[model samples]
Target: MSALTETDPTGAGFSPEGLARIAPWMDRLVDEGRLAGLSVTVARRGRVAFARACGQADLARATPFTLDTVTRIYSMTKPLTSVAVMQLYEQGLFQLDDPVSRVLPEFAEMRVAVGGNRAKLETEPARRAITVRDLLTHTAGLTYGFMEATLVDAQYREHGVDYLAREGTLAEMTARVAKLPLLAQPGSAWNYSVATDVLGQFVAALSGRPFADYLREAVIGPLGMIDTDFFVRPELMPRFCATYAYDRARQLRLFDDSVETAFAKPPAIASGGGGLVSTAADYQRFCRMILNRGTLDGTRLLGRKTVELMLSNHLPGDLAAMGTPRFAETSYTGIGFGLGFSVMLDPARAQILGTPGEVAWGGLASTAFWIDPAEDLSVVLMTQLVPSSALPIRRELRVLTYAALAD
Candidate 1:
């Protein structure tokens, strides 16, 4: 939609030639109907190296994508939610291993779904309470709204606890979620779940402020991320890109937004798990803070130690529970889960050619971004497609980004 495909006037590590190298790959994706639109940005040493928009925001509609386009970032909200909790962590309000129930009474008597079926939920006192750290690392036995092909999905649907819906505040949603059975015991395994949302609730309860309010005061406002929020403003709504899904026929389908859905702005439910809408520039400021070790420009968001804690791995030997059984040593090497982001425990295990101790994550909209401390590189690739978890295209982009490095 917006092509500065020409060389950078600033020549900040990225040349126009670097962008041209990826043009064919991006063009190929457009031609093959693989993506509706893409907004790509690469930064090195805290400066924007390259930023570009290509193709239509909706491949099916031919609506051209632009720099201001907004796409649902889905799970990309995790890192931000994680940061919010860490702000509390810096205050010494709670320790990483503190039992979650200590702060939120509802989680005190939590139970697990013993029979693997939501209907078979049997009450059993967990050997240990889910800890604040557990929520951040996703090891708190929480489960996504959709887990198995069985009763778990049914239970989620019946509860009306729409995670993607923008209805209730984080606390309200947490109260509803607490009534459900946990999928596993705390600290025993990894599960991609609503734990971070719960963490957001914890943030509100501890801070005595709404989650969004706390985030804005503690992080967003401090960092100057003015464009990000749970709900897009009336004026900014025009920049919101149309959402699309790739069908079996490899065609893009325009998906209608549902008011009842979480994306429409809930009553108070600010899902720390997946309720954020961000721009490349907005998120780059965040990555820059991480790259700067808890500070950006001259302001400090967290201490250096706190930032390290977030980027370090906290996983035990429960890869299967974490849903990473297929991960090999090369890609997962020294890689582990930290408070809110993926810690690169083993650079080789990460499969991508990144620095050791690099931390990164992506959104479900095919938005993948990583902050590589070793290389002093942070890259973000944003698009409007759902379920962007597929590897080849993302992997190719990562490789290409690395290849473009001047070294």
Candidate 2:
């Protein structure tokens, strides 16, 4: 809805000729029917160097995508939820190493799965309780049912451990998650899991406010991310893009209708993991806050040191060293999981054009964002496709975006 296409990026340290390539690239993607609709915004040194949208928000309606087009950001919500929890950490509400059970009694004592099938599970006492940092780092041994690679993941499916089930509140579902056998011992490994959803419950219990409310007041509101939320309000529905998936024929097909989407209303459980709909404009601001060391427009949601800690690598080594055999939101090579984002350790090792210490993440929908501290850059690239692995757009855009840098 806002006319935000970049008017001039030369002043922002980008070559005009290089920036010119983006429009045709987007046009090619749209014209070839690779994307139904897409929007991208790139900012460096707090100035937008390139911002544009192409394709249709709704193939049926021919709605144009724009900066305000709302998208299901999915796992991108993890960073925001992680930031919210760290706000309490800054208050000394709890130590990062403190057991999660200190706030949610459901995880007080837990068992780890050594081996077994989905029909029966073998377990032993966990080496230690899952700590708050474990949840933040995704080392608490939880597994997403969707991974379907291990018995614990199957158990998650069997017991409905997903936040999408709409069975109860964040607290109620997280308690169920605690009852399940952990895929591994706490701090023993990293697996993409429902750790962030549990972190949502932890925030609610310690802050004495609902997870969604606290997230808004402490993080989203302060950043002025008005259009970023777990649900899209009625007034904003018109700009909400329809989600898509590749059919067996490899053609785009409607996945989630914009008008009938569950995100059109509040969710039963606030999924801090893979929830929240946002626009390129709103998410860019979120990335900018992180790029700006936890402050945006004079609103400080977290201390600078806390953000530094978050952006720093937390794993013992790169993700490939973790030996996690599960489908993840990020590549497990030359990348390390930070508190809330994937820290790029080496561009050469990762085989991607990126700077070390770049914090980034993507969603179930082929949406992605990254904040490169070395380059003073933040970018949000949005499209409505499901299963991000469906395309190599993120990597392609990264090359295009970084190539335009003149300073």
Candidate 3:
């Protein structure tokens, strides 16, 4: 029942007793069979205040979850991909409003679904071309195949426009996506689509290298995210954790074994929307960079103004109220989608303990991280569970974290 604590590097005020509550709460979830394992890291004013891991990394093997245990961060990869695109943006490579067709000719001719279901769909010319901004904000006329309720979503599935399919290269998969009809017109509605994956291809096109290679050489390498990548290396496979999903009985069931996961090998497509394995420490560095206004350890990835623009809400006049279906457990009531993460507009409307302008995002496996520039704080929680909505753990973690601030 003992939890590990790290000496506060910056000596930013934090109550030891308040921080003490985290591990026990996390342990309770593991003991209750809600989580196979979990790791939490909290920092304030650039100081490491709390770092702890509980339960097993691989329950079948009885492996203990450690700080170094790498886990699939899934959709959390969006923010990182956004940063890469912004790096190119900083270099005058492309403007946010530029038509995506300028770089990826595949999107030059796109269509929008007019009516009918997946069985008999009707199409018409797009009102306007999809832009780079649409890709960053999920306002593009794209849709994910898992959103089967929509006819365009069904088309996405039928055409194999999957982020995790591991079948063809990103260019090929995106071409397949282009062949499908868009769910909405550009800048009209929000659909959590493969827009970021398209952004990754855009990055590669702009950087003159493979998306993975540019990400490594430009962002990951410069930021010192040594353990973050599209695939885990052979020697590091032992540190990879198993993923789980709840069964019909509401008990833990193996989803993906650590020893036998697609992440252990190079993926055919580097999914910018939901692909990447990283440790808590590695992700913390990435968060720290964002909180520090795009610089960490003398490495500058973005300009201060660019980071400010990324954190601001770009949706027009309460577009968050456009009633987009909640693909995950997120409540968009008082939330706004920024370039890469969700920005809290009003604390009361969100009905959660948070500050305005706080930005955060999570993964399909339940891993999440948030950066609070107002308080100079960043919190990261890592665990492996499918359908991240299974538990309200992220909200709970936020409450526990904000209440622990002593300053």
Best by TM-score: 2
Worst 10 contiguous positions by lDDT, candidate 1: 1-10
- Ranked by lDDT, the better of candidates 1 and 2 is 2
Poorest lDDT segment (10 consecutive residues) of candidate 3:
1-10
User: What order do candidates take by TM-score, descending?
Assistant: 2, 3, 1
Per-residue lDDT tens digits for candidate 3, residues 260-303, read: 88888999888888889998988999988999899999879999
Model 1, runs deviating above 4 Å? 1-19, 59-62, 116-119, 149-153, 166-169, 257-267, 317-334
Candidate 3 residue pairs in backbone clash:
none
lDDT of 2 at 399: 88
Q: How many clashing residue pairs appear in each of the predictions shown?
A: 27, 0, 0
Error of 2 at 278 (Å): 0.8
| lDDT by residue (tens digit), candidate 1, 1-407 | 02223235245565456555776888778778777778777777655667777888654345677766766776778898888888888888989888988899999888777674444555567788888888988888777665544354456667876766645556667888888877678877766778888888888899999887888788877887766787776666656777667677767776644222334453357778887887777787888888888987788998898887788778874243355432211134455777777766644655566666777777766787788877777877778776654335677877777777764
Question: Which candidate would rank higher by lDDT, 1 or 3?
Answer: 3
Q: What RMSD value applies to candidate 3?
A: 2.4
